[model samples]
Target chain A: MIDKPFNNKAWLFVLPVFFLVAISAIIPLMTVVNYSIQDTFGNNQYFYVGTEWYTEVLGSSRFHDALGRNLLFSGIILLIEIPLGIFIALSMPRKGFWVPVCLILMALPLLIPWNVVGTIWQVFGRADIGLLGRVLTGLGVDYNYATNWLDAWITIIVMDVWHWTSLVVLLCYSGLVAIPEAYYQAARIDGASKWKVFRYIQLPKMQRVLLIAVLLRFMDSFMIYTEPFVLTGGGPGNSTTFLSIDLVNMAIGQFDLGPAAAMSIIYFLIILLLSWVFYTVMSNFGADAPNKEVG
Target chain B: MAQISLDKLAHSYVAKPQTDADFALKQIDYVWQDGGAYALLGPSGCGKTTLLNIISGLLTPSKGHIRFDDDDVTLRSPEQRNIAQVFQFPVIYDTMTVEQNLAFPLVNRGVARSEIDRRVADMLDTLDLKDKARQRARGLSADEKQKISLGRGLVRYDVNAILFDEPLTVIDPHMKWQLRTKLKQLHEQFGHTMIYVTHDQTEALTFADKVVVMYEGEVVQIGTPEELFDEPAHTFVGYFIGSPGMNVLPCEVDKNIVHMAGAKFTLNKGYADLVGKLEIGIRPEFIDVKSAAEANGAGVAIQVTAVENIGRHKIVRGTVNGYAIDVLTDEDQSIPSDAYAVFNTSRFNVYQNSHLVRAHS
Candidate 1:
């Protein structure tokens, strides 16, 4: 290797970035860490707690229930969204005037603010006067989101899917469009069926974008708060209180600063670990295509 | 294994073509014999690829029918026509291994597994890609990828014809020759009808038994390399097929004599009163450069401008009465200030309106 010139002045170039990160992220995290290790009472009086909050938060079944709910919600949304998004993207016109129109319609949901989407779904799913609820109640089905936990869950799930599936569609559309026209021509000449073309050509080409979509949707759904908070205010019976909402309730609603800080740290770690796992697994997909006969 | 025929084939990109100029391929009526290796040669935007696409059923001509052994395949798809085409750049399934890429066409047709394996193995060996058989096709070099593209076409044994559209454009210069030789060998061994499209003269001249020369959406001439070289039917052919091309000079035709550039030359055969713009065509290879004393009152004197020493021969570029003329001479020959360009009478061709005028003996 060629010898690189020894230069310590390069470190000066990183000073601005260091200060930016310290101000934006590191400083706040340190305050949370400080709170997790101490007990705070009224008038700023404090005492050393020494991991008591960590033990209580980790052992509580409320935390376990909220974590389970978050996992299930993320899982259900992903299972519905990824395939549906890919289908919508594939069905969209590849050319002509309608392409931009379809793209704009897909993007419309994403442009709406998160809480606005929640409030829109909240009124839309109201059994008293909303169109969907009125139609369901008139059709003889008992649909009430205010009291029934299952109805609340279904409403939120539907609302989330409607709001976010467009993101997945746009990502997958860009991937699909990036594929060259020659590949399609070659596939036609090879006599491949439509399914085979998708499996061997389109699917492989979309792998990178799909990985990104999965990671974003997973993290976004896992840390979901604004929509569910505005829609059901955590739920009829704490059934839809996902991790972020539960953390907010503990930190601000009940003012359990120590335990909530401890819980938030744990929540952050779990997301980091799961995202790493997802990235590792998704990036390795199709690395080595199946070989019937090895050379 | 089928003789492909194009019957009055013409295509226009526009829906309503008002004139011949609108046609991308203007009325091509030719038949490629079974087991024949033909090259469709032309410059870019000359509709060579359009004609190749029509033959492979990737395109349906605006008019006329395409037949493969009496079966009209005008409305058929590429799959229905059983045609194979290798594109300009390599088009391989990136997720497939080299062997799988080669076997794709056969697999899609539902050929027996054993047959696919055998054909793929044979193709791998033929293309010298056996060493990389298990490797993913995407990671290979461009030439290797191109070989896989060619292998995919060759793996199908019963294709009506294999069409190539500038398939070697991405290949390295050295690799182009090897792949071209391999293709020729494969064609000879299997007796498959092949139509290779290219803008390179050397590729067309070397790979084809009969070279179909096209110009501006029209088939100008169809002949062997020798025929194209010896007597180019059109002035464009004479200019396009040669290295320095043919020297075309405006002239007046009178009975059995031709007068050009203030000089007179006699023809072997008499020509009746020719109409339209008249000219004489001669290849640079046939013209001899002589000193003034050596010319002996024959030929015309040209003001020599430049000389290029191209290894085996020297190209003498000169101008006579404002018309540029090139003469090929042995590399060792010395140039004199008073250079005379003697036309080889037997090789001279007369043209009327850019089309060759045959002399009546």
Candidate 2:
């Protein structure tokens, strides 16, 4: 009933979005592509390199290391955040005077600007003045994120968990609330054990939101740079120099704009490819669920 | 077989019930004989649903004792009660197949695998969902999902009772009748103790052996459909158990005569000794339409308002003594502009203070 004739006039309504993306994204993307294929010599000189930068960047061991670290961080975050978030959402109260209070408290961290999280933790993990480091030092433990690669990694991992666990919790709580009470009643009558209820009903019902949680956490953790950058300065012999950090170091520190742009394009492509896989899999799972029911 | 009994049951969702109004469900005592089919019929916000929840052990009553087959189970959980409940909406695992959803209860109880398969297969065939047994529940329509809920309830044979809370509300118009008929057949075959709760009278009247009509916080009357129709024990019952309800006309009762609105009418008997609010109730099915001057049958008179001619019958609506009445006539019956409704005197009952005056009936 809601379907109407497909008119070309609809293009007029979408023109603004098309132009906005083209200017902000398409143009910059074209510039990166141009830089990947071309070489710029000193004093405004130029030469055609034709995929030379791509071969060099792909051959670099530093690129491989950064990609491995990125994948590891995303995997760890997903594993820790998803189940922990579901537990917290399940234990939360549904309706009462304290419901809004509890929700507001959970949301306070999500709204506190991502970069500010880095800065706050930067001062927070300091040995001399930071609360965490001061406590650790007092406990007769030697901890210095600035000098030790292990300390840097743990600090980044813990910081990422603190900042982004709330997002997963929020998404999961919404999914839990969306479940009708009838399902619970059904579970009760079926004499389903508590674990069975969680497995067959609660877990399956949260699939869509869980997918969203995974994608958001993966993208955020993979692209993470600011916190580690401010906390350790990619220090201890570049042990924590993730892709984004290295990209910044190459472009601004070493003045290698061509290679940096090429690396940026490659970085953007990796995220795009993985995200597309996730979207396809999630949507396919959704469509396939119903068809199997009736087929 | 289980005979469910409630002894002096009362519930209040407050710290203390200081007055009668404080109770959400007033003190009620009742019983359902083994294998009896009963319906707790009431409008929304009435205590019928709450009472059902209490008996199901979803809620413990503030003051009561409950028994199943003479076993005191007032402190029992829903698990301990061993009762099955169907919800208003379909509740099924969208990820699981239809056969799996039906088999879930058995598997949870660790029933024998072979028996589980047999029961699940039988249910799939009964519900006509055999073709969909392998498909996930997500693809099924609303009615199909509801049928799964019902099938899951019936798939088990050892449960104490099956409770339905308006299970047909979301079903399609055509499927509602079929599902109701199916449920009736299941009851006849198995004789499971079933307590159905519904606001719709058609469902209650046709499905229940005894309809427990509830109003506000109390059970007003419980009787067979014929008893409720021919002689309503309460004004609420008379106004509830049929389409168009019964017409309640305020009347002044003498020994054998009644005065209403401005006209005098005669009945077979009268209730001069009846106390409290006096009124007469007659079902739409028993009332007949006649010319204004014709006066053979005994009952209050009326003014014809509108005529709705259904294919098989006509519902001729009118008002008598400032109270509304509807008379059913054949589709071909002519309704005069000025008509007098003849309320079948023997079928009518006089209510005093909302309760039936038995002496008059």
Candidate 3:
């Protein structure tokens, strides 16, 4: 049988979104591309530099340090948040009045603006006035996020976890709720232990959502800017200076357009490459993971 | 292997159930014999699943005692009770192979590794899943997953009973019959007390030696398939059992004579002082279609409306005195316009207020 004729008119429905994305993302990306390849002193004057800035940004230890810090931060946050989020979701009430209460409380951190969260934590981590700092200091610990490198890193990591763990919790909670009651009943009849039920049933059912959680947390933490900028300001000797903060310092702070533009392009490509790698490895792992059947 | 007994069992989802309507299952005291295959047959919301859950210890009845061979297991968990249940939909562990899924319960019970392997292998062969033994359960079709579910229940030899809650609901029609026969064979081989629940009459009648019919949270009748068809205990049973169900007509009863739709029908037994809403029930198979002359001024003259040829038998639909009645006739039986519908008095059942009323001796 002849296949139905292709519907060319479907393009009309897609034109609006295509034009919107072109204007909002593609055009700006092209401008960044243009700036990255050229050297501009001022007043629209341009000179073709041809990969000189790429080499400079790549060779700079400052860019390297910031990239390393971003990777460490993303790694630490993912390790903490994914498991903790799943733990909290598992402990949460499956039904009754407390369900909405727990959900709304978990969502509160996510609803706060990033800058507001950073500002709140910035004041909250002050040793003299903040409850956390005062408690730690009163307990005879020399804790000061404003001056100590380790303190700064700890405070920033804690703040990031506080701000983003809710997203993971919500995703996992939805996955847990979508599981049918029959699986648990069957498990009970099978005399399965709690861990076995979780290992074989709950964990497999939550895989898709857990993948989304990992990807979102990774991308968000890697590109995290406003929170750290407001809280630590990438200070305490650049201990918490992530990649985005470093890129901003290059582009707007120093006004080093050529190097900053090149750094920005490299940053975008790094994120893209890493995310693609993550997607490929994870999707393949998911496919190869036995017992990933959904009921 | 164990005789299951439910003593004064009742359940309600409500915190404080003051009325019978609030209860999901009314007071039920019944005993299921050891090594018997029984079916709990009912329409939706009739609490068959609720009763099964109570027996399996998945649910605790509001007031009841569940006994297995003289042992009180009322407060025991399903694991402790040693019962196996297959749900309406297949509940196979997706991450495991078919063999692993079958061996799960046995392994959980700390059964020896060799024994578990032997049991799993035997179950795989029995379920015709030997080829798919090492295949992940996630990719199997619904019927195959259900077969795995059944195999999981059957793999454990120590289970007291196996409860199936509409296990064939997701199975395709052809596969349903095959799996059903396999289940019957398994029951014969193992001698496990099995309680199968379903709303489908054919599945109930074919699979069960004795069918327990439930309606509106109460057990209406519990009898063999032949008994259920021949003599229903309530109007709901009459309506819910057969294909077209039993034909129940309103009647005015006076001793042995019953007047209905301007015609009189005599009963084999007399009902003296019978009160309340009176009605007569008769199965379609027992109704006879006769020519006007052959009827010999007996039976009710009905206006024939429709004749449905149902392969094996023809159903004659007609109206007598504005009351509709159905007569099951042979395939070659010709339907005449002027036909009288006759009811075999020996097979007639009298109902008073929706319940079967026995005639005075």
**Local accuracy of candidate 1 as per-residue lDDT tens digits, A1-295:** 9999989898899989999999999999999988998997779998999899989999999999999999999999999999999999999999999999999999999999999998898998899879999999999999999889999999988988999999999999999999988889899999999999999999999999999999999999999998889978988989889889999988899999999999988999999999999999887765654333334
Lowest-sum lDDT 10-residue window in model 2 chain B: B292-301
TM-score of chain B of 1: 0.99
lDDT of 2 at B331: 88
Q: Which tens-of-lDDT digit does each residue in B1-361 have in candidate 3?
A: 6999999999999999999999999999999999999999999999999999999999999998999999999999999998899999999887777888999999898999998988888988888988777778888899999998888888888789999999999999999999999999999999999999999999999999999999989999999999898889999999899978899999899888888778887776888777899889989999889988888987888889999999989999999889999899999988777899887878888899999988886
What's the residue-level lDDT of B179 in candidate 2? 92
lDDT of 2 by residue, A1-295 (tens): 8998989999999999999999999998998888778888788787888888888899899999988888887788878888888888888898989789878888888888767887888788889999999999999879888888898888888888888888888898898898998788778878899899888888888888988988888888889898878877687778788899999999899988788888999999999899888878876664475655443
What local lDDT does model 2 show for residue B144? 93
- Output the worst ten-in-a-row residue range by lDDT, candidate 2 chain A: A286-295
Report the number of the highest-TM-score candidate.
3
Residue-level lDDT of model 2, residues B1-361, one tens digit each, is 5999999999998888899888889988899988989999999978998898888888889998989988998888887788889989999887678888999988988999999999999989888998889888878899999999988888888889999999999999999999999999989988999999999988999999999988888988889988888788888888887777787878777877767656676777756576578888877888888876675544456778888987889999878767777888888888776677776666767778878886543
Report the CAPRI category for model 3.
Answer: acceptable
**Candidate 1 vs 3: which has more lDDT:** 1
What DockQ does model 3 achieve? 0.47
For model 1, chain A alone compared with the true chain A gives a TM-score of 0.95
Model 2 pairs in collision? A293-B135, A293-B136
RMSD to native, candidate 2: 2.6
